[model samples]
Target: MAQGQSDPSCRRSPPPGGRSLRQRYSGDHLQRILLVRGLLKLLLVVAVLAGATAAGWQPATAWWAARNRPKFDTLAAEQGDVIEVINSTGTIEPVQSVQVGAFVSGPIVGLHADFNGEVKEGDLLAEIDPRTYRAVVARDKAALAARRAELERGAARLQQARREEDRSNALAERNVASISESDLDQAHFTRVGMEAEIVMAEAAIEQAEANLDTSEANLGYTKILAPVAGIIIDRKVELGQTLAAQFQTPELFVIAPDMRREMRIFASVDEADIGQIRLAQESGKSVQFSVDAYPGEVFEGKIAQIRLASTTTQNVVTYPVVLSTPNPELKLLPGMTAEISFQVDRRDGVIKVPNAALRFYPVRDHVREADRVILDGTALEADDQARGESPSASAKAEAEGERKRRHVWVVEADGLLRGIPVTSGIGDHRATEIVSGDVEPGQRLVVGVAPKDD
Candidate 1:
C-alpha cells in the first residue's frame, strides 16, 4: 500500500504481526474485565451470605432455647400424712365349714336336702332303711321278755325250796323225823341254789334290755338330721345309695351356717408382704373388694383374723388373711374370687405433685442457677438423706447425716426456668407428696424439656 493512500482490503487489514498483536491485546482486555467482574460478584455473594448468617443467629438460638426449655404444670404441695409402708394379698374362705356325715351305715332310703338348700337345726336331711334295725330291736325285746319269764319261774322255785328247808329243820329239831333225814335235807340247801339261779336270770334280763335300747337308738340314727341350722352346700348321697361305715363315716352332706349373716374373705399374702398384715378378731378397720362377677362394684368388710398357717407352693410361701363381711342381702356366696384392697393407710388434704416433676433436669446454666435460687428460698427437712441410710439405723442418725437436696424446675414470670428444692414424702408410683417445698398450689413445675435440632 502507498503511504497515505491505501487499498480497501489493505486498509481494513493490519500488518500480519500488527494484526496478531491487536488480537492478543483485545483477548487480554476481555479476560481482565471478566476476571474483575467475577471478583466483584464473589465479593457481593460473600456480603449477602454474611448478612444472612448475622440475621439468622438470634432466631436460631431462640428456637433452640425454646425447644430445650422445660415446661411444667402447676401443683400445690399441702400438708398431709402418708403411710410409709404396707403390702399383702390372699383368698376368700369361710370361717367355718361343716361336713355332714352319716352316723350309721345303711341304704339311703330318701333324700330330703340337696346342694344349696337352706336348713334349720333338727331338720331331716336323709333317711336310711329302718327294717333291719327294727328287726334287731324286736329280737332284743323278745329276748328281754323271755329272760323276765325265766326270772319269775326261778323266784317261784326259790319260794317252794325255802318252805321245804324250813319244815325239814323244824322236824329234826323236834325229833319227829329221823336225824339223818333232817341232815340230808339241810345239806341240799335248796333255797340258796334257787336264789342264785333267780339272780342269774335277772342279770340276763337286764343285759337283754340294754341291748334292746342300743338297737332302738341305732334305728333312730337311720333318720339323718341336721345338727345345726345352715344351708346345704353339697350332698353326696342319693336315694337307695348304700353307705358303709366300716372304716370311716361316709360324708353325705356339707353345710354352711347362715350365709346371710356373714362371710369370710381369704387372701393369700406373699411371704415378703405378710409382715404388714395385722390380724384382729374385731378390728373396726374395714376393707373394700370387688369380684370379676361384679365389675365396677365394691364390697366392704372388716378384718377378722390373720391365719398363722402358711402354705408353700412352687417355692413361694403365702399366708391367708381372713376378712368378715356381712352378707345380709346374700349377694356374696362361697368360693367367690375377689380383688381386695386392705386400707393399710390413707392420707387426706396433702400437697401432691406429679412424679415426673421431681425427676426433671435442666440444660442451661442460667436457668439452673435460677432454680437453685428458688430452691434455697424454700427450706425443707432433709428426709431423703435418712432414706439413703440403712433401714436398721436409728432415726436420729439418719436425720443428722448430710443429704443431697432434690431439685425441680419452676417457670418464672420472665418465661425462664429455675430449680427449686423439695422434701418428698410418701409416694405411689404415679404421684409424690411434698412434705415441704416452695411450690404453691397453682405454680407450674417442669417435668422434662424437648430436645432441639442443632
Candidate 2:
C-alpha cells in the first residue's frame, strides 16, 4: 500500500474500538426514553402517596377523637324525702282591722291615744272641742225647766176652774145662788179650756226633754271612743286638727284588732296551682313561710280562707289566700313580705334520684345502637312499651298514658352506657321520688359530661 493510503477491504468502515453512529444514536434515544419512563413512575408514586395521605387523614383523626372522649359527671340515687311544694309571695297583716272616724264636725283638742297604743272597748282615743255643744245642752236644759214650770202653773189653774165649776153647779141645783144657768155653763167650759191648756203644757215639756236629750248626745260625741279592743295602728287626727263630717265621716284612726296575738298572711296563688292549694286546705295542711325581716326564722301557719274573688294583672289571674299564724313574740309585723311554701305531696324514705340525671341528654354514639332509636324521637305505642312487648320496657305510667316514657344513662362494667327507665311520683327542685323502676339506693347514675380541657 502507498503512504497514507490503505487497501479498501482492510480500511475501517467504522472506527476501531468505537460503535457506529446509528448505534450511538439508538443508545442515546433509548437512554432518553428510560429517563422519561423513570420520571413518569416517580410522578405516579407521588400521586399515589398524596391520595393515600388524603384518604387516611380523616379516618385517623376520627379514630383519635373517638379515643379521646369527654369525661362524664355522675350522681348516686339516694333515699330521702321528696316534697312537692307550691311557692308564693305573701304580705303579713292583721286578721281584722277597724277604722275609727269622726261622727261630728269639730276641731280635735286632746289626743288620748298614740300610735301603737292599745285601747279597750269604749276607751277614749281623742277629744274634740265641746264648747259649742255644751252651750246647746244648757239651752235645752233651760227650755225643759221652763216647760215644767208652765205645766205646774196650768195644772193649778185647771184645779181652780174645776172647784169653781163644782160650786156653781151645786148652787144652781140647790136654787140658793143668784147666778144664771149661763154662768154655770161658762164655769164648766172654763174648766175644760184649762184642762186643754194643761195638756198642751205637758206636751211642750216632753218636747223640751227630747231636745235636751239630743243636745246631750251631741255633747257626748265630742269625746271620741274606741269601739273595739285593739292597737292603734294609725293616728290620723292630731291636736288642733279640724275634721269636717258634712258629707262622709272622716277617718280619725285605724286600729288592728288582736294584732299581738295573731297575724295573717295574704298570698296571691296562681290559678294553675289553685286546685292543689284547695285540696291541701281541705286536708288542713300546714304552711311554712319565711320573711325578709327575719331571715333565719321560719313561721308556720294554717290556711284560713280562699277567696272566690280573683284578681287579674297583666293577663295573669290569681286568687287570694289567707293564712293565719300566731304572733305571740310579735316578730312578724304588718307589711312584711313573706315567702310561703305549700307542700302538696310528700314522700318519705323513698328511692330518689337527682333531677340533673333525668335532664341529661347524651349523643347517639354514647348510647347503645338499639336505644339510639329512642333519642331519634321514634314514637312507640304506649301500651306496647308499658307491657314490655319489646325487649326494652318503660315505666308502668306509660301504659295509663298519664306520664311519658323516659330513660336515664348509667355506665356499664365494660365502659359502655346502659339506660334505665323509671316512673317519677313526687319531686322537688333538686330531687325526685322514683315510683317504679329498677333503681336502688347508692346506684350511680350519669348526670352530664365534663368539659374538655382547652
Candidate 3:
C-alpha cells in the first residue's frame, strides 16, 4: 500500500485493529440493544393498561352508589279523633270482704258452711266443741244457786234474832227475864254482823250471776256465727281442727260479701302516668278493662278513689287506684287480673299526623340550620291569630303550660324537606292531634327514610 492510500478491502471496512460500526453492533453489543428495545415495549404496555383503568373507574363507582342509595318514606296528614290514655294493671276484689275467725279457742266439731256456700248474716258457719264451755256454765250455775241459798239462810237467821229479841223484851217487861238477857237479845238483833252477812251473801249471788252470764256468752261464741251475708270463698278449718287463738285470732273462713252487688278493682298506677288519672265518678269518664280469661270481652268501670299512699319497687314509684264496677251476673271473680285503660283526654275532628312523622329527622347533610323552623307557644298563637283562628284563653294557657316543643317535617314544593314547629295535644301514641301548626291535612310529611345499606 502507498503511504496515504489503503487497500480497497481495508478501506471498504475498517483497519486491521478496528471494526466497522455494523460489525461492532452485530456481536455481544447487539444483546444490549435488544434489552433496551424490550424495556420500551414493556413501558408502552404499562401506560396503555393505566389509561384504560383510569377511564373505567369513575362509572363503576357511580353505578355502585346509585344501586345502594336509600329511599325516603312519607306519610299523609289526616283528620280524626285522637284520644290520650293511661294504661295499668289491676286485681279484681269484692267490694266488701269479711274474714270470719274464731274468737275462742276450741276444737271444731261441725261445719255448716263450705267453700262457695252462700250464707246470710248471723248464720252458723262452724261449730267449736262446746262441752267444756257447757261445763263452765253448769259450774257457774251451781255457784249461783248456792249463793242464793246462803242469802236466804242469812235472812232467816236475822228473822230468828229479831223474834228472840222481841220475846226477851216482853219477858223483861213482865219481870220474867233479867235486864242482861233482854239487853243481850237486843244486841243480837241490833248488831251489824247479821246485816253485813246478808249483804255479803247477796253480793256473792250477784257476782255468780254475772259469771254465769259471761260463761253463757262465751258458749254462744262457739257457734261461729257469720257477721255479714256473703259467700264462703275460703275455709281454713276442717272438722276436728283445733284453733288456738293465743297471739292472734284464728281465721276460719273468708267471706266475699254480696257477689250480686258491685265489685272493686285495685290498680297500680305508675308515678309517671298518675297525673292523667282522676276519679271517673267525678269526671264522668268510663274506664275499660279486660281479663286474661275473657280476652275478647271488655268490662266497664268507674274510678272510686286514688290512694295518696305510694309504693316503691326497684326505684319505681306507684300508687294504688280503686275502681268500681257492677257485677249483676257475678262474672267478675275475686283475684282475677285485669288490664285497665283510662281515657285522659280526647279531641275530635282535628288535624292529626302519625307519631312517626313527628319523630323523624333528616340526614345531617340534607338539612341546614337556617332551614329549621322552631316556634314557641307565643309565636304559634300569633300565627293562629293571623290565620283568623282565634284561640281561647284556656287553649293558650294549655299551650304555654306544655314543657315540650314538638316538631314535624313537611316536604315543600321543592324536592327538599323543612321542619314545622307545632303545638300538639291528645296523642294516642299511634297518632297525635296537631293543635296549632302551619301544616294541613293531605300534606305529605316524611316519617322515616330507609336506612343506608352500609
Candidate 4:
C-alpha cells in the first residue's frame, strides 16, 4: 500500500442508507469550502458596499459644508482717502432752554399754557391776582395828588411871607418901628419856613410817584408771558396757586427754543477713542446713530464740537462729544439715549478680505511643508528665502514684500484648497483691508470651519 493510503478497516464505513465514508467526507469538505467561499464573497461585497457608502458620503458632506459655510461679502481697498479717527457720544438737547418764572408774589388766577403748548415771544402764559397791586397804585396816586396840593399851598405862603417881610423892613428903615419891633416884624424867617415846607411837599410828591411806578411794575408782572418763541416743555404753576417770590422766583413753565431745527447730542468718548474726535468742520466725519426707541432706524448727524472738558466716572475719563442733527420731523426727543458710531476710516477700490482670513492659523508643519514645496519648485532661491521669513518681520520690510508674503487658503476651481499670498492693511473685527492680493471684490471668504463628524 502507498505510504499515504488509508486502510479500509481504519476508515469508518457509512451507515445503511448513507453515503460511503469517502463520499461523506468529500461532501462535508466541499460544503465547508462552499461555506468559506460564500462567507468570503459576502465579506467582499460588504467591504465594497462600505467603501461605496463612504465615497458617496464624502461629497454630500462637502457639498453641505460648502453650501452652509459662513460666507463674507468682500470689499475693495483702494487708494481713496479714509478718515483717520473719530470718537464721541451725547444726549439730544435743545439749543436754548428757558425757565419762565413770576416776578411778584401773587395767586395765579389763570393758566394759559400747558405742557407741549406752542408759544411765541410775549405770549401770555399765565395771569396772577392783580387786586393788591391795583389798590397800591390807587393809593399812591391819591398821595401824589395830596402832596402836589400841599406844595401849591406852601408856594403861596412863601410868596405872602416875602411880601410881608419887605413891608416890615421898609417900616423899620423909615423909623416908624423900634429895633425890637423891626426884628420881630421881619418876615424873612417865616418865608424860609414856608420854603422848607414847599421842599418837603415836593419830596413827598416824588416819593409817591416812585411808589406809583413800582406798583405799576408789580401790576404788569401779574401777567406771565413767554420770553421766547418756543414750545412749553413743563408747567409748574397751576390756576389759583399762590406763589411767593420773596425767596425765589417761582417757576411757572419751562420752554425749549426750537423743535424743527437742529438738536445737540451730548456723548462721552472713551479715553481710548478720544484722539479720533474732531470738529465736524475739520474732520467732516459723518456719524450715524440709533436709540432704544427706534431700534432699526438710523439717524444721521455731523460732528459739531469736541469739548475739552473731560469727565471721569469710576476712574475712567471720557471727553464729551457734541453732534448736531436735524429734527425736521421732530422724531428725536430730548433725553433719548443714543448709540453712536463715527465712520473713521474706509478703503475703496482695493481688495478686501474677511478679518478671519488674516486670523486663521494653519498647522505649523503644514505651513513649513508648503513653503518647502514652493521653494523647491522655484529657481529664485533668494526670493523664496525672503518669502519664508516671519510675517511680522516681513511686514516691516518692503511694502510689496509685506503684501506678497502672507497667504490664505481659497477653494480652487477643482474643489481643492490652494494658498494665495496677500498683504493686509487696516481692518475692523469683521473685515480686513487687503493691500495686495489676487482676491477680487464679491468673492466669498471663509470665516469659519465646520467640525468633522465622527
The top-ranked prediction according to lDDT is 2
- Per-residue CA lDDT of candidate 4, range 1-454, in tens? 9998988899766787687645667777878878999999999999999999998998999998776543332233233333333434568887778999999998889888989888999999999999999998999889889989999998999999988888778767878645456464457788788889989999998998999999899999999989999889888878899999999989989999877788888888887776655533465868888888889899999888878899999999988888889989888888888888787766665556665666554433333444545434443655757777654555557645544456666544543345666877656555666777777766554444545444
lDDT, residue 446, candidate 1: 75
Query: Native-vs-model 4 lDDT?
Result: 0.75
Per-residue C-alpha lDDT of model 3 across residues 280-336, encoded as one tens digit per residue: 446778899999888989999988889999999999999999999998887899999
The better-scoring model by TM-score among 2 and 3 is 2
Q: Which ranges of candidate 3 are over 4 A from the true structure?
A: 1-70, 165-177, 181-191, 279-281, 368-404, 412-414, 451-454
Question: Whole-model Cα lDDT per candidate?
Answer: 0.74, 0.88, 0.83, 0.75
Q: Whose TM-score is greatest here?
A: 2
Q: Encode model 2's per-residue lDDT on 346-367: one tens digit a residue.
A: 8899998999988888887877
Q: Please tell me which model should have the higher lDDT, number 1 or number 2.
A: 2
- The better-scoring model by lDDT among 2 and 4 is 2
**Candidate 1 TM-score over all chains jointly:** 0.73
